[model samples]
Target chain A: MRITIIGSGNVATHLAAAFKNGGHRIVQVYSREIQNAALLAYHVKAEAIDRLQDIDPETDLFVIAVKDDAIFSLGLSLAPYKKLTVHTSGATALTVLSSIMPNSGVLYPLQTLSKNKEVDFLNVPLCIEGPDEQTTRILEQLAQTISNKVYRINSAQRKVLHLAAVFACNFPNYLYEVARRLLDKQNIDFELIRPLILETAQKVQENLPVEVQTGPAVRNDENTMKMHLQMLQDEPGLQMIYELLSQGIIKNTKDGH
Target chain B: MRITIIGSGNVATHLAAAFKNGGHRIVQVYSREIQNAALLAYHVKAEAIDRLQDIDPETDLFVIAVKDDAIFSLGLSLAPYKKLTVHTSGATALTVLSSIMPNSGVLYPLQTLSKNKEVDFLNVPLCIEGPDEQTTRILEQLAQTISNKVYRINSAQRKVLHLAAVFACNFPNYLYEVARRLLDKQNIDFELIRPLILETAQKVQENLPVEVQTGPAVRNDENTMKMHLQMLQDEPGLQMIYELLSQGIIKNTKDGH
Candidate 1:
């Protein structure tokens, strides 16, 4: 399949390569910054364009793999390309593209894409939604070429999934930061928590996390919680997070019981 | 070393088996409940006792690996065996044990230990703290037998480390639960998020997490955040968490910039 990637960020760079690896043609790479566009286009053997007006209309799929805020503007820019266009975003609505393009859909790869790291697109769940059935089918087939798991998720469901991803991936990473800072304050190496973090994540593959929940908060050991709160007096923000989350967990446990 | 495990919890069971694997003899196991004691003792090749009066003073180290609240009481019960006691807790002060023993120390294995899952003590950080120089040296040597990394962390530092583990391990696991429930609401398999979660975690090892942070929250995409809040109106508690954490991340980013 012929493709035009409309972004030069991490998602666009990674996806362009993955598509190329999957035996698809990357015909063009677009970016507001000419250097970024040229960088990705160089790797994919494609044309680099700073302006969307320069986009080749002959491409089979136009992927608006830019930031959430830029999707609408990008769609408007690519309005002349009546070809199938999709954005690689979880939170943005499919209508954002359909509002401009005659043929539009979503080709959201449900994974955190980074330029430094090459992701296994085959494992990523590609969420596809479209303005019409034909475009949806084409987008679905396109996604299935790179990924084994494909889902027909509408805007509402996709938004929920995106929100859930925030809790699962983004919030947890912040929690890790908090942990690292706490340990660093006491001259403790953050590496010490690596094994524990990995094990905690691994447990979810085998068991329901609620069933496997352990620690002072879930157990409602008030004494340990009190001591931790006292220790965290210097970090009022973290203390607020700890207190709220613990109360939430305890309330959840009681409701379960 | 003739080790007597004075608890039948997850930490006690893992430590007893690890010691046994390291060719040390587990003399006995003690618990408030006889069944709990017997279950662990059977695995460690030791006798089980329900009463404190039944404790034999012949063991080299009487490990008070009980709950945080029970440590002081259990230590008081074994006060006669003064100079031969230790507790495996990062949060509790060594003085809690010293009040009941002439020699006492900490042998905190820095990992989240679960009863069902087996742990490789060799990789777990053993944070050892003792009252006197000789006792500290002996404890360090004992720790070296099970783990490659051993630190002489005082009570103040160990408590901080414990608090850090709560953020790293416990809080992340809780966030995972929140994600699972949110996905469940949309009839999306929570498993779809697994690869993303794994990749998010793997990224930290390769790059500085703050540099690699990408999400609607991290991007400060107010439009997406507002839409998510509207979608999550039914889940007020989760909504609050999402809003507050996003605010915190945005604040951090502003400061960073």
Candidate 2:
């Protein structure tokens, strides 16, 4: 299948490469900045185009892999082709494409993708959403070629998943930075806590996150909690984060499992 | 070397087993409940003693692996032994043991330990802090026997690490639970986000977490963030967490690197 990729960001680059590696032809890569598109295109062995009008007309599928805001305009531009069109966005709704194109869907890869780091595409969960049955099946088949884990998720579920991804990936990452900052204050190398972070994440792989939760909060170690809050006295933001999250853990743990 | 483990919780059990495997004899395992002590003792081929009075006189080292508040009282009880004593606590100061014993230190294993789950003891980072050089070296030597990674940390630094651990391990876990709850509302399985969690952690192993931070917060995707905040409107607590953490990421990212 001939695929044309729009945008040149991390998600776009990763998806484009995965598609190419899965035996699909990347007809052209599009970016507002032609050089950016060219860089990605060079890796996938595809043509690079600066304008949407220059997108390959011979493309079998056009993937609008741009930011959420850019997806509507890009989708509008590609609607004329009537080729199977999809956008790799978790937040954008299928309705954004449903009215414009008869064959429209979403191929949302639910993982943090970075262009510099290579991820095992097969392990990345692909959330596929489509305007209709055939389009959904097509996206799933396309996704399965590149990834082992693919689910036919609806627009609502995709949105929920995206929001959840923020908590699971983004927010936790922020917490890690907070941890780094805390250690930095004491001149302790952040590397010391790296193993603990890795093991914590690894635990959730086999066990439920809630079931395997451990901390001063869960254990109700008030003295330690008091000392921690005192340590963060100067920074009320961190103190609040510590208090709220600790309370949340205690409440959640006590509520049920 | 003969070691007696005080407290039969996760740390005590794991440490006792590790010490035994490292060619040190675990002379006794002590807990408030004899059954708990006996259970751990059975695993490590040691005697079970519930009372402090029954602490083996022949023990070379006494390891107190109880809760933070319990450390002082337990240390006081074992003060007469005057053996090279240590507590496996990140929060409690070494003074708790120093006043009680001539040779006191800390052998804090900085990984989340659960009795049900077997951890790779070799990968667990042992943070050792001793009152004197001699005691520090002894603990370091003992720590080296069970784990490949060991660090000489002072009380202040250990406390900082403990606080950091809350941010790195505990708080991130609560966020994971938040993600799970969000998915649960939509009847989606929590398993889907597990890979993202794992990869997020794996990324930090090679890259500074702040360097690899990715999300709407870092990307400054106002549109998606708005949608997310709206989605979480009913739950004000979660809404606040979303806003603050996102703001934190935005602020932190912009500050430096």
Candidate 3:
């Protein structure tokens, strides 16, 4: 399969390499900046293009791996290709791309991507969606070649998954930052909490997160909660977050969710 | 050193086993219920006692491993011993025990402890505090016998560390529970997000969390944030949490935190 990757960002670089490594032909790489395109294109043995007119119309697939807001506008350039165009976004709906391209689909990788950090795509779940049965099947086949887990998720379900990913991945990383800052102020080493963070995530692999949840909030230990709140009094932002999340945990536990 | 473990809960059980494994003599295990005490005592080859009168006053140290609220009352019951009594609590002040026992100190382990889950004491940071330098040194020596990391943290510093732990470990686990529920409602397997969660935590091991954070919130992508808010309208509690955390993340990013 010949593929043209649009965008020179993290997702674009990762997908380009994965496809090439999986024995698919990456025919071209595109970016507004030619240098950015050439950097990734050099490794995949593909042509790099800065101009929209230079895109190869003969490729079997066009993957728009740009930012969430840029997907629709950048996708407009690919309408002339009339190929199966897919966007690698979790938040954007399939209809957004399908509206411009008749053979549009979604090949969203359900994992965080970083340019410097290499990920094993085989374990990442590929959430696929298409406008028609045949298109969906073709996307699934391609997805299976790169990933072991593939799911046919509709637009509405995909939106919810994207929201959940923010909570599961993004919010926790911010909380870790907060923890690091708090310890930094006290001259405590941030490495002290790395094991706890790793073990907390590892526990979820074998058990439901709710079942393994521990801390003052889950145990309803008011004394510790009060002390924590008192300690964060100077930092109103952290205090507000602490209160809201603790209440959420209590409510969820009471509701048996 | 001869150690008497008061309370047979998660912390007590782990500490008892670690102390025994470090070649120290565990004098006794104490609990309100005889069965609870006997269960842990059998593993450490120590006597089990339910009554305060049965506690051996000759022991070198008495480690109080009860709940936060119970620590005060339980410590009063053993006031006759007048030994170096220490409570393994994060939120409670070191002065709380020092006020009751003249030779009190703190032997707080800065890690989450679960009875069924075995943890290596060598990596767990043992925070020690005492009324005097000699007692602090004694606790530090005992901590060093089982763990490599030991620090002399005061009550105020320990309280802050505990608060940071809540944000790093407890709050992240709650967010994971929220993600699990959202995916469960859509019939999506929660296993799909496990790799993301692990990688998110793993990133912190090599880089500062603030430098490595990624998501709509950190990027200030209002479009994705607005869509997420709209999707979470029905669940007001979750929506409120989402708004507060996102706002906090944006504020932190803008403030160059």
Evaluated on CA atoms against the true complex, candidate 3 attains a DockQ of: 0.73
Q: Which stretches of model 2 miss by more than 4 angstroms?
A: none
For residues B8-116, write the lDDT of model 2, one tens digit per residue. Answer: 9989989998999899999999999999999999999999988888877998999999988889888888888778889999998899889767889999999999887
lDDT of each: 0.84, 0.91, 0.89
Q: Clashes in each model (backbone N, CA, C under 3 Å)?
A: 0, 0, 0
Q: Pick the candidate with the highest DockQ.
A: 2
Q: After superposition, how far is residue A159 of candidate 2 from its true place, in Å?
A: 0.9
Q: What is the C-alpha lDDT profile of model 1 across A1-257, one tens digit per residue?
A: 89999999888988898899889999999999999999999999999999867878888888888889888887887777677788988888888888776888998888887787777778888889988898789888878888898989998888888888898888887787777777777777777777777777777777667766777898798999999999888878778888878887898798893
Q: Write the per-residue lDDT of candidate 1 for residues B1-257, one digit (tens) a residue.
A: 99999999888989999899888999999999999999999998899999888988888988888888889988887887764789998779999988767888899988877887776788888899998899999999998887887889999988888888888778877888888888897798888887777777777766656666778888888888998899889978878788878877787788793
TM-score of chain A of each: 0.95, 0.97, 0.96
Give the least accurate 10-residue stretch of model 1 chain B, judged by summed lDDT. B203-212
Clashing residue pairs in candidate 3, if any? none
Q: Per-prediction TM-score, please?
A: 0.95, 0.98, 0.94
lDDT of 3 at A177: 86
- Ten-residue region with minimum lDDT total, candidate 1 chain A: A203-212
Candidate 3 lDDT score relative to the true structure: 0.89
TM-score of 1: 0.95
TM-score of chain B of 2: 0.97
Candidate 1: clashing pairs of residues: none
The full ranking of all candidates by TM-score, starting with the best, is 2, 1, 3
